[model samples]
Target chain A: MSFDLGLVIEYFPRLLSGAGLTVELIAISSLVGICIAVPVGLMRVSASPTLRNLSLAYVFFFRGTPLLIQIFLVYYGLSQFEAVRNSVLWPFLRQPYWCAIVAFALNTGAYTAEILRGAMQAVPRGEIEAARAFGMSTALLFRRVILPRAVRIGWPAYGNEVIFMIKGSALASTITLLDLTGMARTIIAKTYAPVEIFLAAGLIYLAIVFVLTRAFRRIEARLNRYLLHESA
Target chain B: MFDLKGFGDQLLLGALMTVGLALSVLCVGTILGLAGAIAKLSKSAPARFAAETYTAVLRGIPELLIVLVIYFGSSGLLTAAAEAMGHDGFVELSPFAAGVTALSLVFGAYATEVFRGAILAIPKGQIEAARAIGMNRRLVFLRVTLPQLWRVALPGLGNLFLVSQKDTALVSVIGLEELTRKAAFATGFTKAPFTFYMAAAVLYLTITSVTMVGLHLAERRASRGMPGMRG
Candidate 1:
């Protein structure tokens, strides 16, 4: 019933070891998510109804459902089919690690795409018109004018999604990956000290979030440096 | 090719439970959020510090860890308390109670910011006018502050509802027989993981879509007569 400081100190290193996979899951999924998001986000605002609708559906389905179910669909559901089990994709699909990555990437991609779409739309229309007035091509205008402004606008929200991704990656533990939560569960099973182990795990997560928050604030400051004098 | 094996009713019940749990958490969370917002905005430094710590710690950690910690930790505390009371047995917290506590904490943390922003969005002149008209603090809040707060807070709260609804799936890990757990059960029973999970996903989407429509209508109603406001 009492707090077990000694037990937490003992198992702190074991919990810290799982930080690697947690960081890896966030990094790879975030990288892959950006790849999917940029295109899908662009498609979201495209003039073509078909492309816009397709991306809309993608974002809708992914955003509408839970990430846990998505992970289950990939990890447990995919292997249920004879075709998927025998397909070339089976090798990667068979691993829970890859499945978690796929689910996280797709989930974050949907959220980021929405954020990107909003940010892109919110880009000052006059800026785009000015780029056109300068005779910049569509691609050049998007690259120089729209994307940078959208990034500046979307960066804070994207940072939130990343933090959510970090929290969500803990669900990867449910599928048996030895992430921080998984490790905490494992140690608790052996030591019968759920409170201590989970407290330690929570501390580690808090540390990760704290560091990321500071990093995001720094990036936001850098991005908005030009607007500083106006605000002052 | 995709039969539910007559578990359709089971899944429906589970979906209902999911909705019920989400609504309950939303109600509790909204109250906590309001209190947290007031505390944060209050002049008392200790009250603000406590509210700040509450949101910071709850928002920073994973909901899963919260669920696990509460599920296990509360039981341990309860059993110890029971032993001190001369009862010699283990005490367990029900999955429902644990689920509600954990999810509400998470929901309330995010909702605090939403409510705080909504509260701050109210024009200072309105509160001043109410006070100038001899309204007490409580009456001013009820008649003046609460009405406008909902208009601004509805959208954010709606989004949080969607989030908490999906987060109900996380409670399944603690053995709550919500939609996700029912699908998992059916999957085990029928050995049809894909069919059941896909069905669950569809069920979730249905709930989400319905909630979205409902929120849209609510927002429209709440923002009625507000000039230049987009419903």
Candidate 2:
């Protein structure tokens, strides 16, 4: 019948802690995801059949399933194995944080790999051929030409991925990692005011995502300036 | 280790419910999406504002948040509004309906983008040529633009549908008896969380894989007369 502002304020500390964990998890997983994505992306677009197929399978499996199921499978399913449970890995599986990170990293890697692969392929064939004509070695060609160009092409979509990952970080809560959404749920259960607290957490998420998108836009504009001048 | 006999019927019931809800959401989402897409494409300012606001709010927030907000918050809001309208009875919003509404809103936003892109992608030349032949706007669009537009739009729409279908799990947060929620419930009851989740994972994989094949076939059929295809 009524909403209370005071109760929302009361639960602010718990919500802050949850938000902190969400951000931390996103930061770590994003870094790990990017590392794996780069090579997987390269492999997906590689010339060799064996490398390409393997990468294809990797992307296919993760992308096909929902991230929720994937997280559960890793945390619950993987731990079912005696070798895994009895092995040194038990301590890691016992932690929800590790499971969240692993699932997020793997899922994000698949999507990011595809995004990067498309970006890599969009780099002009003639440009690469010209580099080859100049007698540049493979490593130098990639370092000087391919990587920079791929990043520039991929930056816009990469911004989309950043927003996606930020939202995705909320899923960690379902695994009992006490992310913002989880904290909101807990607070609502305690205070019995669902709208106010969830709204607060959501607003905070919106602010973070808005800032991220703006930062990406600035970097993108700076990158595109060179292209604009070249075209003009 | 798998207790296949005891829970098989219940899991089947859940799977059917999951598919049922996915289709229901898709229908609702399509209606919302068409309206939003039209509104966004309209010339009037109010229409544009309404559509843009819907997209911005829905897109900026996570789908999970939308689900939670609708499932948890909307009932109270609805009840209050009903009382204000001189209604005495409780206006109940079931978790299933709330889940559907949440999903439709989220899917509608993405679909607006897809539909807008598809409309923009229809070639101007063909429309012009049809007009030159004295065809009316409706006729020209139906004959010239719409035909080619489907070929262009189908893949993107298919992808959207697949993603939306998987995304139905967001509703699980609200206790819908969908695949994810069903598995979660069974996990809690059986104390074999891993087995249930694995089954759920495999089921999702099966759906996506089968859909992939279906999409491939559809693409081939749709691209039959296209100029630049390898297959």
Candidate number with greatest TM-score:
1
DockQ scores of the candidates: 0.81, 0.63
DockQ for candidate 1, C-alpha atoms: 0.81
TM-score of each: 0.96, 0.90
Q: What is the lDDT of residue A93 in candidate 1?
A: 91
For this target, which candidate reaches the highest lDDT against the unseen true structure? 1
**Per-residue lDDT over A1-232 for candidate 2, one digit per residue giving the tens place of the 0 to 100 score:** 6778787788888888888888888889889999999999989978899999999989988887788888888887787677888988788888999999999999989999999999988999999999999999988998899989999999999888878888878788777878988888877777777888888888878877788889999999999899889999
List, in the given order, the native-contact fraction of each candidate: 0.87, 0.65
Residue A231 in candidate 1, Cα distance off native in Å = 5.9
Which window of 10 residues has the lowest lDDT sum in candidate 1 chain B?
A: B222-231
State which docking tier applies to candidate 1.
high
* TM-score of chain B taken alone, candidate 2: 0.84
lDDT of 1 by residue, A1-101 (tens): 77879888888888998988899999999999999999999999999999999999999999999999999999999999999999999989999899999
Off by over 4 Å in 1: A229-232, B78-92
Q: Score candidate 2 by DockQ.
A: 0.63
